[model samples]
Target chain A: MRLIFMIAVLAAGLLYTFYAFNTLNFLSASGRLGPGFFPQILGLGIVSMTLISVITEARRMRATTNYFAAPADAFPGSALLIICMSVLYLIGLRLFGAIPGSIVFLLAMFWMISRGKPILNTVIAVMAPVLIYLLFRQLLSASMPEGLIPLPF
Target chain B: MEIFSDLMMGMSVALHPANLLYLLVGAFVGMTIGVIPGFGPAAGIALLLPVTFGMDPVGAVMMLSAIYYGAMYGGSITAILINTPGDAGSVASTLDGFPLAQQGRAGPALVMQAVASFTGGTVGVILITLLAPLFSQVARNFGPPEYFLLAIMGMLTLIVMIGGNWRLGVISALIGFALGTVGVDLESGRSRYTFGSAELIGGINFIPVAIGLFGLGELFFAFYSGSHKKRDGEMLTYDGKSNFWPNARDFIETRFTLVRGSIIGFVVGVIPGAGAAIAALIAYSVERSVSPRPENFGKGEMAGLVAPEAANNAASSGAMIPLLTLGIPGSASTAILLAAFLMWGLRPGPLLMEQNPEFAWGLIASMYLGNMALLLISIFAIPVFVLILKVPYRILAPLVVVVCTLGTFSVNSSYMEMYIMLGAGVIGFFMRLYGFSPAAVVLALVLGPLAEESLRQTLTISRGSFGIFITRPASLSIIVVTIALLVLLPLIQLYGQRVRKPKAS
Candidate 1:
């Protein structure tokens, strides 16, 4: 998994360097260092460094027989679930607006994580969103996602 | 004498009702953030950055800076009580802190830590009062070559401090430099990586990226580590029923320790990338070596707790010097503070003092009052923080996600930025999991543009001569210091490791 992540970074670095070389000019029309100069250096640095990292990681994995084993306490499933819920929450915000979407997401998340305390979860879900609305929308005058179905408030 | 009047004027500005209120709120919030294990001042300040948008720049910065140092004070609470250092800086405190608690001396340990922190923080502020203007004066003579070298020096020092993971740290910094290359080129008026999007023209906003990386990334990493599933096992209780305050002998024993820790911590803190954690560990080592009762060290020794408590707080204060004088952040938390300063249109370099004396001095003045307030709060508000610790990570995790999302969205009202934030968060989690430094990434992102611009200007002046860096006296000085730090820091790190390894076994 670590090697895969490093390889992915290497691929991105290659694309970034490719753009630097092909699209951006190394020197400006005035003969000064241009946009590509720094990017070229950074891109090369990233690709080379990440490649070394990948090789080092691969060697370590090969050396260790239990390299593939997960730690006893790791909860990758819970993290993935939370991440998926966050994505859905964002989509829900686009569909149902900030206040309503947040309430529903929080309530559902509390239900999933905390469990067995519906009333407490419901109160927190409702109160948290309302406080956030007052703080951001009313007090700070910052914009919130109004969504397609905007609330009357 | 002039510094005195300046501080007086600053005190007047900081004494404003609104600014005072902001300071108190900031100190409280900072302490609260510190009590949570794994969350540090960087995450707290980043998460709260958007909320300061509507505030006056002076008040907002005061609050943020309060959060920065207040966290150092608060981190010791958990170290003493639960043996879990709230942040890296507090890790040294856990050496003697938890042992003291186990010995039923939790009250004295708690009170002594607060006093030591206060002493360190206050002494550090005094040094800043005496030294910042001089540092600023020296920096005023620096040119483009010097600025570029300073940025390089900062990055190299940070990477070198990453020890065995130096390659990963370099990659992280390079990634930051890449992100900084987005938006239109200021010098040539060309778009490099925007992909023709209008939103990308202004480049990546630091607020969202900072919030996502430190805030959401840490939360995700905490979940992955199964922190939510773990129970808080038998926290040592401090009822204040007996021996709550340190005796005269305790004070007498630690008097020299406090002064030594403060000076050592301050000196270490001024060096870029040598943060509070390193300062605390070094102070602990120094105190042990110097003490007559060295054998008693790490076995509920008061000086053990006092030395690190003072050193960490002082180091936090010392970090502000570089940020204020050189426009270079020493650590991730200070980097966010730098972003906040930029957001408010307040450039923090030499001229910041001459042009915005009120803003600069007011921030300095607020620290004095902030330390006093934190001392009182750290003592009296123990129960409140203890109660906060009881709240399970499982219940707190979801709410934090909501806050991170909302905070990122509120900044620009752009879904693209939110998406960027989410992407950064996932990357941040992976980076943390893989021994990469998110702090390095954020620091590079902040410094990349400056470095590029300085390098361009230097080359232009020297007619593309690379020798221009060596020709400039200031640049040469920075290079020498960078080299010296590179040599010395590892040895200091080795000493710290030697101190810890014996105890751990």
Candidate 2:
């Protein structure tokens, strides 16, 4: 897992470096340090350091058989589920707007995480959206996602 | 006499009913955020930053700064009660805090910590009041070369303090610098890495990235660690009836410890990258070393709890010196504060006090009042926070996600920023799991543009000769300090480890 993350970073670093070198100028036409100068250094540094980290992490993992062993406390299953749910919630926000999308998301989330409490979940799902709507929209007058399907007050 | 009158003007500003109300709200919110394990001031401030958009700049900054120092007071509550440090700054508090709680001295422990924190915080503000003007006067002479070197010094000191994983820390900071290079080049009128998106043209908004990384990312990691499933530890209860307050011996015995811890914490806090956690740990170590009863150090010693509490609170104050005078944030939380300052069109530097006395001194004065408020809150409001702790992480997780998402959207009403926040959250989760420093990334992101601009200007002035950094007295001084910090931080870390190993064993 660590090796994969490091490799991902390295790949991104390489792409960044490629763009920095190919697209951006190191010195401006007027002979000043241009936009690429900083990014070039940063990109190269990231690529090199990440490559070293990957190599070191890979070597260490090879020597340790239990490197893949999950800790007793880890709940990767639930964590992954939450991530998926969050993505769905984002999609819901796009479709149904802030209030309705948040209501659905909260209902679904509470049902999943805090089971056997429909009454509490329902109350929270309804009230939380209303409260957040009040706080963001009414009180602060901040913009909320009007969504493709706008809601009437 | 001049300082005295300036403070009086600040007091008048801070004492306004509206400003006081904001201060109270910030203090309350800060404490609430701090009580939750895994949620620190960085996340709290980011999560709330957008809400301050319509607020008066002084009130907004006062509230944010309150949240920053207020977290220091709130973190210890959980550390003492549940053996879980709410933030890194409270880790040392758990050493003696939990032990003291276990010994059934939880009440005394809690009150004494509040007192110690109040003392340290107030003393820090006093020092700030006296020294900030002097520091500002000196910092006014700094040129581009000096500023650039200072930025590098901040990053290097942070990386060096990351101990064995210094390479990974560097990589994390590099990632931040990379992110910071997004958007149009202000100088050359060329977009660097925006990929031709209008949203990308403005570069990444700091609020969403901050909220995602520190808020959602930390929450997700907490879930991954099975914190939601784990039942709370047996809480040591303290009814306000009996044995609640500390005895006279508690204060008398630790009289010198409080002073020593405050001074150490303040000094450490003034240094870039050495934050409250280091200050607390170093104070604990120093207190132990100098104690007549070293054996009693971690065994529910009043001084043990007092030293770290004092140190962490003072360190929080100490960190403000750089931010207020030099416009450089030494830690993730302060970086968010800097972002807030910029959002309000208030650039914090040497001229901040001269140009915006009302905002600067108003903030400084609020800290004095804030420490008093926090002391009262920390003592009288314990039961409220204890109730907060009873609320499980499982239920809180989704609501937090909702807040982070909606908060991101509220800032610009832009779906793209929300998406960026979500992406950053996922990436931040992986970063946390893999031992990379998210704080370092955020700090670098804040400092990257400043560092780049200053370096370019320095080179331009020097005709592309880097020797200008050595020739300038201010730049040379920064170089000497950076080198010294790079050499000294590792030794300090070593000493902290040496002291910590015994307690761990």
RMSD of each: 1.4, 1.3
Across B134-194, the per-residue lDDT of candidate 1 in tens digits comes to 9999999998999888888888888887776888999999998899999999999999799
What digit string (tens of lDDT, one per residue) describes model 2 on residues B1-505? Answer: 9999999999999999999999999998999999998888999899989888778889999999999888888889999988888899999998888888888898899999999999999999999999999999999999899888888888888888777788989999999988999998899879878887988887888988899899889988998988778654335455445578889999999999999999999999999898999899999999999999988876788999999999999999999999999999999999999999999999999999999999889999999999999999998888898888887777788899999999999999999999988888988999889888889999999999999999999999999999999999888889999999888878888998888777788
TM-score of chain B of each: 0.98, 0.98
* Model 2: CA > 4 A from native: A151-153, B232-242
In Å, residue B179's CA in model 1 sits off its true spot by: 0.9
Cα lDDT listed for each candidate: 0.89, 0.90
Query: Tens-digit lDDT track for model 1 on A95-149?
Result: 8888898998998888888886788888989998889988998999998887777
Candidate 1, pairs of clashing residues? none
TM-score of chain A of each: 0.93, 0.95
Tell me the fnat of candidate 2.
Answer: 0.79
Residue-wise C-alpha lDDT for candidate 2, range A99-133, written one tens digit per residue: 89999998998888877568977998889888988
Error of 2 at A14 (Å): 0.7
